[model samples]
Target: MKLAATAGGGLFLGFSWTGSLASALEVVSDTAIAAGEINFNSYLALSPDGIVTILSPNPELGQNIKTSFPMIVAEELDADWTKVKVVQAPLDTNKFERQVTGGSGAVPHSWERLRKAGATARHMLLEAAAKRWKVSAGTLRTENGFVLNPANGKKLSYGELATEASKVPVPENVKLKDPKDFKLIGTAVRNVDNHEMITGKPLYGLDFYKDGMLFAMIQRPTAFGLKLKSVDATAAKAMPGIVDVVTFKNNVAVVGKSTWQVSKARKALKVQYEAEAALESSADHDRIFKELLNSTDATVRRKDGDVEAAFKSAAKVIKSEYQCPFLSHSPMEPMNFFAHVRPDGVELVGPTQTPERARDQVAELLKIAPEKVTVQLTRLGGGFGRRLSADFALEAAELSSIIKAPVKVIWSREDDMTGGTYRPAVRYRFEAALDAKGNMIGYKLRGVGMNSGNPTREDNFPSGAVDNLLIDSVEHKSPITTGPWRAPITNFLAFAEQSFIDEVAHAAGKDPVQFRLELLDKAKKSPVGEIKYDIDRMRGVINLAAEKSGWGKKKGVAQGFSVYFSHRSYVAQVGEVELKDNKPVIKKIYAAADCGMVVNLSGANQQVRGGIVDGLGHAMYSNLTFKNGAPEQENFNSYRLIRMKEIPEVDVHFVHNGIDPTGLGEPALPPTGGAVANAIFKATGKRLRNQPFAEQEELKTV
Candidate 1:
């Protein structure tokens, strides 16, 4: 990466694959700018008018990176926040090392690199001012886009020194501000694209439009593990605005001038799919998982101490089975992508969480070099790990190549719901051995799940927090596509482990929060193996959540507590609820999180709150059951989501820490299901082991 001067009198920061930095005097042509905007070092650019434009590399999935990334740059540049503008950078692997946005690593990975870019620019401005005043560079300080000399009362605007600053040497190393001195960070800053989002501006993939772009929709196989055998498109092809019908290995596509026409044509077309074997249903999966759980032959992921000996000598033993149904991402904006595949190259514009993967997939499909494919990212309505797959973008590229015209492929809500790549349903068997004193001495867990070859994550929560622990896993092969959803495996594991822990706490006659704290303290003092979690940090959030929620106080509402760690962040949540006619009426939820340094307080809070709601919705009524390997719920009606009326007031608090920022998008989600389940247990004295609590007949009578 190098910073140079452009012919348009603006600073240019260009990234080269050769890893060589250009000299300050090197002049680049104005054509290097993409869309007439100055190229910043892949991240930061300075215009002649002093307006600083920062390029955000990560995809914005409502996590507020559009504002947070620029805030980091402005903080280090000593630039006026008001004058800073944030632009979504197009996906270019040569320019950025990583453009994938899942796993909540956007801020943690880019914090140092972005800060360095801003600091380097600030240093150049200071050097330019010093040379003009014939004073030492150390004597000048930058304040709000200006070089300031306190003693002489001299100040120069960054715009005035922009040309001169472009000629100064880029500093090899620059100083970053201490957290204590931050002005914009840790403060509540408004989202940069709030206005565009509120006024219904075109910022999403589905909202993208191009002249002469044909709309396309696909009719996927009726069942999983099926192939497109035959299609009758005569009736559809004669319809108004219908262009052509194409067939792929897995599905049939309908291409037309408008989305409505394409959708109607797809529905009008008759399709036949061929399956190799009889489609397996959810009942079959449940039976297979149960058999796996009972079988002793399983892969051991973790073992500490003698679990058999501990269990044999135990005075009491508690065993339970937990099951969670498969779930759908169900993003508000259904999967859509615009692709223009020409002889020269392929251009793609869409809402994808993994743009680099999308670019590579398109290149591979088009039989062109990766560089020939350009992916432009738009604001995503929601991801939840579904956008991590590039299938949607690849479909658009394929359709465009076949039609020889720019095409936008859209998936209806039904298509998105029944389409493949769902969160794998899992079953967990847990056993705990307790001594005469009610102290747990041994723990054993056996997990059976689909899609993931390894059903259990050995280093998940409570792995290193306990002694005499044994973790085993069994995988069941299925044709249904499955992928990461929210916190991935932790989304279901946390609920299982935390709810079991709550049961153990009740058996030991201890408060749930206190019991967890004691276990954390034990782990901190005498950890059995490599303790992956920070015991101190975990205890901090747990204590904070208890304090904020008045944990033990009776507020006429049953309270449930859960704590979990994921993606390098620790979170504790408490759900308060009351039984209303045998149904859980959630009143409030309090959450405490320690995700290191908070970038934007408001954004962090919203992420935690949003994650909580998402988890609660899944635990409450969201489920995707399959019969004959076909999804039973085709839309929001059957596959229910938490509505606005059902949302409870969520109170979120962050533990003030000076550590470098981690990720907040996922950590807060894993514990919400467990907390709500525990609260329901307290209210009705019925332990809800299965997810989608509303569907359980046992819970309805309680």
Candidate 2:
């Protein structure tokens, strides 16, 4: 990519396939890029009206990257935040290599590059001002989009120097501002699109429209291991607004003029599915998982000192089993995509987390090169790892290709809930051996879950945290499709592991927080195998949370504490619960996170709050079960989500360390389940080994 002057004397940042600006030029424009706007490479642009537009390459899924990313650029550029505008960049692999946004690495991945881009612009502007004023470039300083000559107290706006700055040679190296001098970052900046969002503007995938766009809904098989056998759409075709009925390999689609008509026509159609064999049920999964947990044939993921000898010589041993059910992503905006497939190429518009992968999938399906597919991302209502699959976008492309027109496929809440690709059900058996001093001597974990293979992530917490540790995993084969949900394996593992740690603390007659601190200290001083976690960071958050929560001083309310590290971030959470009518009612949650340097304090706080609420909701009531290969829960009525009334006020704190930012989207979530579960145990004296804690019989008893 290279910067060039536009025909209107404005700057243009042109992208080329060969990196050489002379060949294969493409200039993509969006609403954020006004006519005659001065472009500064792929990330930044300046207009004559003093509007600094920053291009955000990553898709925004409520993580506030739309606001935070531009803040990074504006801070380095010395551009006024009030004058900065963030726009979503069109997907260009040659310019921005990775357009995906699932791992919460957008800020970390783009930090240096974006800062450099901004600094480069600042340097060029300084050079232009120096040439005009015949002064030393080093003597000039930029502040809020103005280059100041402190010697004479003279200043010039960036817009005034745009033309001359574009002619200045791009600097190969530029000095970045010190973090201590940062003004925009580490401060609370409201989302740039907050106005658009609250005003109900057209921003999401469902809001996209065309002159003759058709609506489509698919009639998917109810069972997991079933295929569409036959579909009779005789009555559906005769219905009002119905355009046509088409059948794919696995599903039948009802096409119409509107989403409501298509949905109604889908219900009128008669469909049948053929199961390959006896459909697997939740009972079968449980039985197989239990058997596999006990089976000797297992993969040994991690093995340290002799666990057998430690257990044999231990003064006491504790054993427990924990199970978590499958979960759905359940983003507020259900899966929907608009696709226009021509003979030459395909154009897709939607809210997907992985657009590059989706583009490749569409290209492959159409027997064309990957470049033939173009995917434009929209503001996502919610994407808790479900949008990473790209199946919905591919589905829209398939239907559009068949119809030879632009079609939008919309999935109802029922379709999103029962459709495949869910969080896998997992079972964990934990064994802890304690010596006479109440110190945990040995630890063993047997995890059984379904994935393409085993979903057990061996490197999860309490792995390197223990010395005499043995981690084994067993896989149970099933027809149920599963994918990443939020924190993935860590989501369930943290709950089971941390809750078991609380039990160990209770057995040792020690405070949960104290016990965890001791273990973290041990892991820090006397290391084990490949400690991927930062013990100091973990202890920092734990101590901060304990101090902030007034952990041991609370009366009348039972408190539970849990700390976990994932996605290179450490988090500790404490939950306060009160028993009412033989049920545990959560009152508040205290969360401490160490996600390196926070980008947007307000956005980071909201992320932690949302994560804690999401984790609690899933643990307390969310569950997915299958009977005869069909999902038991169809919608919100059956698959329960924590309502506003059930949500507790989350108090968030972050460790103020000057480290590079890690992931914030998922790290705050893992500890919430364990904290809530431990709190329930303290309140009702019941060990809730299974998830959906509301269904526990112990809690049901008065």
Which 10 residues in a row give candidate 2 its minimum summed lDDT? 15-24
Clashing pairs in 2: none
RMSD of each: 3.6, 3.3
Ten residues in sequence with the least summed lDDT for candidate 1: 16-25
Per-residue lDDT of 1-702 in model 2, one digit per residue for the tens?
A: 122222234645554322322223455553323335676677888766677879888888998888888888898999998878788876778778578777767877888888898999999999999999999999999999999999999999987887688779988899999999999889998999999989999999989898888999999888988888888899999999999999987989999999999998999999888997669888988888878888999899889999999999999999999999889999999999999887767778899999888988988888888776777789998989999998999899999999998999999999999997988888999999999999998999989888725555566656676779988888876788888899888888899999999999999898999998888777777777887778788889999999999998989899999998888898999999997776678999999999999989999999999999889999989989989999999998898999999899889999999988987989899999999989988998888888888887866773
Q: What is the Cα-based TM-score of model 2?
A: 0.95
lDDT (10s digit) by residue, model 1, range 1-702: 222232345534543311122111244555565222344366777766667778888899999988898888889989988888788988766566678788989999988988888888888889989999999999889898889998799999876777678778777888888878888888899999999989999999989998889999999888887777888999999999999999976778999999999888888988887887668799999889889998878999999999999999998888988899899999999999999888777788999999989988888888888877777789998989999999999999998898899999999999999998899999999998888887788999999999766667788657776789999998888889899899998898899989999998898888988888777777878788887778889899999999999998976799999999899999999999997876778899999999999999999989999999999989888889999989999998888999999889999998987999998989999999999999988988989899898898758787
> Candidate 2 local accuracy as lDDT?
0.86
